[model samples]
Target: MPAESQRLYERIAQKLANDISRGQYKIGQRLPSERELAQTFSVSRPTVREAIIALELDRLVEVRVGSGVYVTNTEPPGGKAGATDIGPFELLEARRSIEGEACALAATRIDDAQLAELNALLTEMRTENEKDVMLSEDADRRFHETIAAATQNSGMIAAVKMLWDARTRSPQSRSLSAKVRATGVKPRIDEHTAILKALRQRDPEGARAAMREHLTRVIDALLKATEVQELERARQQIAEQRKRYAASQ
Candidate 1:
């Protein structure tokens, strides 16, 4: 296929996948007909079908015969908020910038009621993490979200939530997370504690530093995982080529 046509299909697929991740199309929800999609995207029916095929490869949606296409439980394929193709690294960089400011603002504004609730969430996270690491991480998300909420800025809250959403929706982000999970690396409770401590002291600089440090650690971990992923890919390619050579002989 020509590169231009392939890119168009990929662009369409990424747009649709972004909508699905944002809950415009719920799981099990049927997508518009190909004819409708083509019209909406200003493309041909064949182009829409190709986009659907790409999404299907990611397991983000299922196409049924004589019925319709529907969303699946799998996360979407790309990050489309800032740039055409935002990778996980870029998304995290954006978060570290925005969320550090959010934490700083939250320190000045958080109330006692909110502080107590945050503490409760941290406790729950620690308990659940002890039981099952992945399942417990929902609290980790909520913890950051709550900090954004304390800032009392709806835009900041939305921005933070969108970043978290992309972490799952983007294939590169998911792959990095999966690699880290395979290594049994769980969330660091001490890090969350540091952020909370800063918040409790009503120290904006401390809170900012803590949040920045936490995300920096996350970026480091992801970098390490990506290196491992690349190494494993090289190993697999070598193995496949050796098999082909032996078979030819």
Candidate 2:
């Protein structure tokens, strides 16, 4: 297999490791089924299996035939963090690099029909947002997948999928996303519209710029979300101390 393809599976394994450490899958707990994980990460069953194997090697999880994978009651191998563990900002940076290029390519190759499909998906997302409904990331995934398909490059499509998988599977990424959502940060409909407009005009550079800017906004949001979480935690701590002091009084 090519180096790039091999690296994709490694990213999957690291994502699992991150999830395990962050307590998404606790010790001795059954991890999500392979099919479920594949669907969640937008990867294939074989790729998911490879990641499970990596986890087993690290003693982070154990796979039992006729049952399923289970988290091990032990730390990751050598008590070291998973090699694939990455910060949320790092994940966004990877997306910015790969998806930006994919967006640029899509600009030149995307057909009118594909463009229409993307617009419909974005409209669906906007409607969901307007209703204050919890917007599903499925539509968001499809929008990016459509762009990758328009690029007409199998490798590019796979790379984009791998990056997205890392985001959904990584504990750090998921925790940051939860914070952002709790803070009521929804998808930026207008930002996506700008990206679509760039593609509609077949402006590669513009498409690239729009995609990069979108991911940059995500990075900024993640940073702000982390700060908000920390501030809230500090407030809780202070409140607890105040209660204790009043009790002494």
Candidate 3:
């Protein structure tokens, strides 16, 4: 894909790769901190994280937890990082929009059988979360798929399925998801329960809001999960300074 058409993270990845190839970041050397990279690229920390994951996928870098990203190779073995896959945050935003509408439609169209299925899936999700939080993703996927099916629209079902497939197939997205899961962030049963309640009540707007809220929280969770520990503490200190300034004023 052309640089102009590429996602922000992909573009950043390409730039970083070029720098690496030029020996700006020699093999075995630690790259700048995530905070520094974000400022240098004028992008968010999460976008920088996505770029780092792309580099990792291309075998150009390695991420060490609680340390920093390191240059593993001067050039990507595949010649370039995976640029075609959607970014994790981008996918979540798309889901928030598409699935919110699908849930709204399902509110009116869902039957008792589908509702029963969704309820069962909710139970499964809760149980899996209790057993091992990471294990709930499968049931979570089914829960959304079931909601899409309840819409009774083939197009909606396909669209939802495509999004889920993208989540699985995108190397960058999958890496980021794995990172998030490693941080102990699992599917929120209460959020799913709220959606089910709205659906059972046959409330379209309520369902839409519930779904959107759920996905919005998911986005927030991803951002938090990917944050570097030092950067998080820095952010907390900044917040405290701002509070103090406000009190002084």
Candidate 4:
């Protein structure tokens, strides 16, 4: 595409994203089709494609193949994609990005009481049975919340709460809670303990390292699961294609 065309579409995409963020496009609603977009924007279909790609990257919309683009959850929208509808994956990613820093901040700001609360939560988690998912998950959730609280940043705490609340409400959040229970079976009882100790000592580097190690496990598992799901989808598509070919014969 020409440079001018690319720039034009990028501009349109940004405008649409701003609108979506402002609730111009209702959540779970479909946006105009590619042809409509091309006509409306006075650009080619390819330009519309580029625009959609940009919107997708912004998490303002999700392109459901063979259907159309749909508004994704932002603020004031419903929860996740599943029945439980906890929230959007983007929010989780955002929280991870910010809260990890919060942990480092908390390390610097932490006091005796905050350290005690964190330790209390960790202790509760250690005694939690594998089958007691709700309690165990709640404990884990509280630990992060406490960490956020320790940072003394209300905005950061609020943002993290929104993401975590959304996540807990999602049906697929089971994937997370279950993963926590399963992968955590070895009992990293000392994981939060290590972080709290570091925080108490005002070791920002140590706190950040601990947060990185903890969140890395989550990122790694989710990536693997996404890959597996993609492979399965591909296999199903191939099987369907083969069946249609045999019927045509």
Candidate 5:
């Protein structure tokens, strides 16, 4: 596909996904008419239809008989938001820019009530089970977004919201998350805890530094995983070629 098309779909899909998850369009709520979406997106009607169809494929929305599109039963896919395609490096870089600022602003303005909410989320997520760890990191994203709101910076709020959406929805995000949690990455957990502490203390700079460190650790881990995935892809390709050659012989 053309680069422009790729970019357009990526943006539109993310917006649609956000609307669904944020309940801008409630479950079973009919989406705006395709004509309306096309005007809203400032693109062709076919482009709007394609976008909607793509969303339906992901189970984010449904098309009902004689009614407009409706959000379906399924949760929107995480991390990439609705991005149809995004590579690991792009994702990590985006995370750095957004979370780095979110933590900074959060420190400046987070209230006791917000801290309590985060504490509750931390309890729900952080655990060392005998055999498994349940990493509810979207809870982590929600906390960050809430903090962005506390900063009362609209730009910060919007940017962090998008990054958080992508972070929570990407397939690679999910896979690496499960991998990291399963392997027991403890210091990273500590980093988040420390960031939370900084927020509780209302130290903006401290919160920023802690968030930066946390993201740095996550990026390093993701790069290693990306390398492994590259190797695996190469191996799979070679194996398939070998099978074909043997059959031809």
Candidate 6:
């Protein structure tokens, strides 16, 4: 694929793969910390994280959580690299742009029944979230799709569904989501409530802003969940050094 056409994470993955193949990162060696890689590539840490996941999928590296990523194989298995999957951050950005408009349109056309359904779903989301149930995500998906259906625009519905499908089906996105969820991040019920309140008020701009803000927070959560805490690692190392000094004394 052309460099311009590829996702930022994909481009980073290709460069890192090349570096590995060229012996710059030897087998079993730990790659640079995520912060260092982000700095070197001039990309965000989440983008670097997606690249690392891509490398893992290709069997070129393995992620050792709370430690670092390590090179496993210089060459991809069967001489074939993994398919370029959509990055999680890229997917969320697309949703923020497209779904914001979808929410605005829905605000004008949504009926009382649709609003009621959204309210019920909101309750469901809260219940499932309190139990830490994965079903909360199902309710979350339906909440957005119901808004699209309210738009009464088939194209809008399809577009929204396509984005949700990508989130469900893309390997890279799924991997990142799994990591994020493992950190106890759940859907934001308050944001969803804000969206529904705007829709009920028939305020298109309010609905748009609320939807955009919700997705923006989701993106922020993903960034934080995937962050490799270099400072924490530094503290651990310091503690180890202090123990060694005490033992010697």
Instruction: For each candidate in the order shown, give its overall lDDT on alpha carbons.
Output: 0.77, 0.77, 0.89, 0.67, 0.66, 0.92
lDDT by residue (tens digit), candidate 2, 111-223 = 99999999999988888776653454668888899999999999999998888888778765665566567777878888899999999999999999999999899777655
Candidate 5 stretches with Cα past 4 Å from truth are 1-84, 128-135, 168-187, 225-249
Task: Rank by TM-score, highest first.
Answer: 6, 3, 2, 1, 4, 5
Query: Which candidate has the highest lDDT of all?
Result: 6
lDDT of 1 at 10: 69
Per-residue accuracy of model 3 over 203-224 as CA lDDT, tens digit each: 9999999999999999889887
Model 4 weakest 10-residue run by lDDT:
79-88
What TM-score against the true fold does each predicted structure earn? 0.59, 0.59, 0.85, 0.52, 0.51, 0.89
Across residues 87-194, which tens digit of lDDT does each residue of candidate 5 receive?
334566676777777878878777778888877766655653322344355556665677778777888888877776775676645554555565564334577788
lDDT of 6 by residue, 90-193 (tens): 89999999999999999999999999999999999999998864789999999999999999999999999999999999988878878878999999989999
Error of 4 at 248 (Å): 36
User: Better model by TM-score, 1 or 5?
Assistant: 1
Deviation of model 6 at 84, angstroms: 1.4
Name the better of 5 and 6 by TM-score. Answer: 6
lDDT of 3 at 80: 55
**Residue pairs in collision within model 2:** none
lDDT, candidate 2, residue 123? 89
Give the clash count for model 4.
4
Clashes of each: 0, 0, 0, 4, 9, 0
